[model samples]
Target: MLQDTTSSAPLRSLLFHLSDVELLTRSARQIVEEEAPPCYTLLIFTNGTGRLYIDNQPFLFSPDHCYLLSPGTSLQIENGTDTVVCFYRITFTVIQARDQQQVLYTEDIFPNRYELRVYPLSRLIRLTEQLYAGRLGKGDMEWFKQHLHFQELIGFLLEHNLHSDPSLSLTQSVENTIHYLNHNFMDSITVKQLVQLANVPHWQYTSIFQELTGKKPLDYLTELRINRSKEWLAISNAPLRDIAHRVGFADEYYFNRRFRQTTGVTPRQYAISMRQRVLVKDWTGHEVHIPLQPLRIIYYGETIGDLVTLGIHPIGGNIPNPENRLYKDPTTIIHDVGFPFNTERASALEPDLIIFANSDERQYEQISKIAPTITYNSWATLEERMHILGDWFGKKREAEQWLVHHHNKTKTMWQQLQSSINAGETASVFTYDHGERLFVMGVTGFSTALYHPLGFRPVSKIQDILDAGQGYKEIQESSLPQYAGDRIFMLLPENKISRRAAEDMMNSTLWQSLPAVQSGHVYMAEEAKWNFGDAFTRDKLLEMLPELLQGF
Candidate 1:
């Protein structure tokens, strides 16, 4: 594997047989006189802009944009104001042709669109580092493997860039609807309500939606309800009647019958079975351990209370008013065992297992001594964390299966809703915070798993920001105009101060002038469950879509 010695972080090198590689950074003062060789080059623009005359056509590049250059293309670079260009160049041999001409890697031409495919670039960077490390060996089989990887890299870039698919836009809209429905499903909603919210006509919406997604609206909704019921049953000790009502099932008997029809078991039976699976089983027999001998696990750092609430309640562990236990429980059990470094108290807990709710490596090492420990990394997105947790508890297979089941259910419901509305309509997810930030969840960060799976496209500018690695950043008051779209999800802040701040922000001259606000397309997401990313969060996003996208 080659290594990029210039970089501080360890990067995996490319497995390909590259003859030469160079990484260069040039400022505006430097003369842009040279043309790139007939080889592959990746140009990353971090804090500057420039223009290149490629095949005699002038094209722009900037910090907000990047480009990949191909062989046999004539090029000339011209610097922009205060511009800087950072680029990587790679020279590699392809199998020679009979005519003695050097064979190129792939014949695919780059697209004209600005959506730079970052995945390939990321891979290339890794591969380059590996190559720099002097790990590439000389062998026939190794050479053949490298050739295959190179071919794959070329193919990926071609498909992502040159061969464009317009269907992605429609698919994105459907996804958006799914995301909305998942997050807001607790409310009373219907297909008619969805058609109205989406602002599309009924017939056109239905056909395209079904064509793309493959299910009717009502069926999807019922599936979502059933799936939500499953989560509630597994995680919460709340009465079945209350759970049914919360999920929009009007009658308990109807909810029970539907749940059984979908899952092949009564809610209580399903809950009990899940609990049984979690209990420690003896090796010789299938006998379950007694409650007094339950698996002894200790939690460390902040958010221990949150995790306990999430885990125990659904698993049939009852401690009436566990929130108050934060005060009454042993300080050893729920201490402020600071994160990323603290480990003394956690190690002394001396339990079978430990969970560090916070992402702290030092604490992780300390707890590892006492027992098997799982430390969650906060930098990862919510879905990433869920997958980690699933693996930690030996439930990856079950978790994946559950995800697939809910995904299918949401897909069916989205298709049904679309069948009842017009095509080309749009929607948004809205929530208000205590700071009155008017946070709009987009297609990355906490909302990526929910939104991407559902097929929603962020409004153009918002999508652009997300693409630029600006997902989860604060939306500027002046930039609100660019986000006006066919639908709006208005989230209100939870606390009084946050609410006041949100009200002030909304009342601002700039915010009130937006098209969405004027047209009454905004729907306030005030539910507490809708605020976070979890199974419940997925439900709320779906439920709200029908209401948010109702009339197009």
Candidate 2:
């Protein structure tokens, strides 16, 4: 592509038509992906570190990177933390002046694999603003103007991308040192050696290393040694001096002191506690020994609202998308551990216990080294989960009391609604998201609440899905009534495309003819606020249900 441009092509000879420009923002734990159309797509990540994949080729997306995807290349960006990712997508067709009908060129363009950074991004942003400024305009003159602006924008991207940021180069060196330290930690290593690898001054290297790992170079190395020693101590009958020497310690006494400082216990005491811990089986059938009265907990799961409701605030956990009303407590003090479990960050927190809530054994293998980790079932019913937690935390009395209180409150709320609800009436939930794709709830979200014994009965198809262990199932618009029931819940998504899809469905003859729609049993709810069934959410529903069905 560069050869074509530099080979002496004039302005009209290499014209590329700009088809669309759209800005998108992804919230925490959200994924935005799509199959490519017959145009090249430029993805400009304005900010945040997201995981990016183009046709399964993964790349780290930070504030500096922009990706150029070829036609029919799949694109996926997963924002795995609390930071919102904002980006611009530019889709355009390449026009070859000498082609038949001058249509889009089918061959892959050069630099179609562009994953580049334009330092001083304001220059690119200004040119992009010009392109977006003209997106709403129409007609041949506007098209011609947009085409020229697109050329200018593409030119600026090419020019600035040739130069790489010096800080980025330095950071790459720091990351390389980190990767080295992670693998070579058993060998004798020093802060000076790591700093040399970073190729920066001592102070600057320390700052960058700490910024990335939340610890100084020497401290991080020591942590690796100590964590490794802990594994040996737990599983092997190794002598303290031998363990110290194997983990890169020249002196066992110094290792003892460092371990004591890091763990608030001597090496001997730690070994003893490991033997004395309460052994229990985790959700995924792993036997783990947990510390008695353990504090400084790190929780990774969707049922954080359960922890909040039980008055047990973990030292670290992820607060997924702030829009969740149940988990939006101003007093919640859990540090964001990141979704997908940022194990390094969790290790830095010095957690005594880690409550991981996924069944991925590979992820479990990594996190278990951070602390005594257990895999939990976030999908378990509230009472069962609470009882399990009560057993683990020695809060059986509190758990039972909370459950009894919840039962009485929900019973009262259901009695109030008994006069309004029809006997044997069923309910079904549907939502549109992921760019107008529609789904029917089965075992997840408020379906968990609506299928409660005291709540609405699930339609037969939905029950079948629940028995089959599906959270939700996607279906075409024509199949809505087949899965919908006497009471319908239309969960409004945050995105405009899905909102429009929901609107189109509500206006359709099929939707209008549904029994729920005709009998005024159709309800609208915010997907963000009501699409969960954790203890906190279920408790919130005690207050919300009456209002939602006030006139039912």
Candidate 3:
């Protein structure tokens, strides 16, 4: 009866009562009707960097941001990239009557469910703490006491939601601090200094910083200094003490210790790996004399898995999103050269060679100055990339071996898949990135792996994109039926909004009505794990596809 439709009308009275109040500390904690009868519940995250899911939709939780959930909404907290999540769950009820006649006006007191960000969140936290503390007492009087505070908290939310913009935002302040840290890594910095820069409480700043950068303030600072020091150690003949001082370290021993800890190698050992020369014309037509047997290499491209599979490990590389890893090994020692290539960090490694994937002349010029940079085409076929990598890195024999192995295994894999999959069945992959944007993969990404002559045919629209040589294209949701094939694959990204949108569509009647969905042929893949078009990811997809296709 309480879950009926709501209509706005004259409200003369409101019956609001606090039904429950508790602090959730565990990551696996869920608020279902069985555990605690679901009502209008407010989640006040005091400290958390975990993913919050409401009825299967993912949400990235931030401290001091209060999310109001509707009645009977399934709340599940899952681990994010970092941090243990903790939040206050305050459940309540609010109903309005028409014209003081006791006729039910509407159950819509505020919005059904929404996230509210108001300045000075300390006030809300204080009230929540007071209410949670009061809940520990055993009495009807305690319930009565907490109800008054609940009313005040509701009033605060309703009033503050009206303000469209606040002069100061905690997220904005932390973002600015991140910029500050990037530019000033050479300067002495601490967590306290960053907290002051953000102008927020110490506890709040920590969670916000971690959520934004996926690293603690001090840890981030240390990485920056070490990265800079790595460059100095390679390019300059400065003493270890001098390099330490210049890179913001107080002592040489401390700098040496941190460098070894982060890079998985001592500074001296890393330097010794860069030497010799082998002249070659790269894909971009630049004649670069690279290292004869490059050991300390920086691979700036999507084909990192190619190196991983080749038994040649790069000491440093560019992983735009750390989630989209080259391999499953968490201990890979590839230092990130940053997206689009952070030339400063690239030069810092003093790499003997830089295998950059971008074809942009401007960016190539910038990165080439750092090392013997070789620009390569990531769009090339797996065999093409391997052949080029082999010649460039003096692994011609190794390259030939992998191609033979790849072709043989690939032929065998599709032969197995052909048994279960119907002939001429088309397969398509799409994803929602950052927001509601829907992008259909064409010749690149998982499509390259899936669209073998023996495997699956491409849908008409996607085939056109493949002909046009475009990696992906955004299409209207209405065109999904046309673009969708006999088999559907959805690559869900790490972005919170994108994941939620994809999840919502999956639950929608329209999505359920799709022919692929009806036949239970729809598959979902993590963007980080499967969305790469690189030969390495394509190879991994070979092993992954059979299991996913057959659901074995």
Candidate 4:
């Protein structure tokens, strides 16, 4: 029997080393990647469409499609489309394979193979972000946990046909059935329906599905419904019956019984417990028990704007003391946690909950000792982070409402600005980081929101920079005209070095000759407010953007 390697049958050491992983964004017509060393590679396309060549074999790839290549494989991806293509690549090696037969048997899983499969990017994207950000520490315990996460990822791929034989008709049939179940889990599903979809006998369909996924077809459907129900239970105030029906259960009583059987807790108990305190899994993948409605909270992260938007004012946070207060109408009494955050002072605030960015991981342990701490990826997209915060705070409705309002406001403002600004007019954002370090912002902070759908378009050069996934490009003052667009928003960083650079730029003839400058389309932006992509910052941008875009 070819047993499923992902199943629990462990022995001996299985050492692994991760070479690199990244979410690459590209807009160039032709982009080629070459590596000196031969290793296993995995690619997941999340945006746009492109043709990828593994060696000489071409595979037409698009969003939600995944590719796995064996050792010594070479890749040449081409994006002929005008839209930007974004994909994630992960490279790693298995140094010491387990000596056991089960482990050794799966060693040649993708041998001489360039396999394309279907795997949802949502699950894999979060894991890739965690690994890329180093939120999982380098400690032995953390390493073990990271390895488990990798195993889970691999298991997901395998379940979808990473190791399945293409010649086997039953394999494809089982896969289709699984896909059907996944997409229609909210509808009443039965063995007869699944078997009909698989186009196979009831017994045969169940047998192959169990062999491939290690779960019976009906059992798999139940698990999917239960998992989705857990998400709704944590984030919504929906009643038990409504929640049960939402996840495909015919009755609330049956849903309660099945939920208890699977999770060892009833639906109502789970909801009540979560209402008091819930176990939150953050970007680090750590399940930390936190208060559902925290009274006193502090955060040592750049998402103060997001916290403020949620209407839960933090007792203390890493609020910047900028020379110019960007957003006025300040009502929350905030205790500054100091630069890099003063742990001792943070403790003095008597906060019951603490939040930090995954980037600021060094302070996690020390700060965690004072209060329960959770970390979020500060670098993720604005929508991604906002939805995550909304889920954690059980304010999804509020988040959705704010987004709707922002969308309406942005639409109206764009319509109004069209009178002065041409339809194809371009914009660019620049910031003075320090002495001689001039950065052109890409898809982050204010730049991201500014270049959103129906918003101003970026210049070709800046668009290429963004497509290449460069957060900010450092450029010389003399090169400003090349990157500057019809309109420019220049951020003034609050530092002596930046002050010196700003003085130098102000004195330069190169700065005065730019098209945007000649037309008086250049505006000064407060660094703190313009550089952050949080809800508060976004709202502030909404309030100020029309004024900035007025009169062309």
Scored by lDDT, the top model is 2
Worst 10 residues of 4 by lDDT: 1-10
Residues 290-317 of candidate 4: C-alpha lDDT, one tens digit per residue: 8887767887776677777767677677
Q: lDDT values of the candidates?
A: 0.50, 0.74, 0.71, 0.69
Summarize candidate 1's per-residue lDDT along 340-456 as a digit string, tens digits. 334554444334445544445564455566544555443344455555555545656755665676577678767767654445545555445536565556543234433443345
Worst 10 residues of 2 by lDDT: 1-10
Which residue pairs overlap in candidate 2's backbone?
Answer: none
Off by over 4 Å in 3: 1-274, 323-331
- The total number of steric clashes, by the backbone 3 Å criterion, in model 4 comes to 0
lDDT of 2: 0.74
Please report the candidate that would top TM-score against the real structure.
Answer: 3
lDDT of 3 by residue, 52-80 (tens): 56666544555565777766666676643
TM-score of each: 0.36, 0.51, 0.53, 0.48
Candidate 2 vs 3: which has more TM-score: 3
Better of 1 and 3 by lDDT: 3
Output the TM-score of candidate 2.
0.51
How big is the positional error of residue 468 in model 2, measured in Å on the Cα after superposition?
2.4
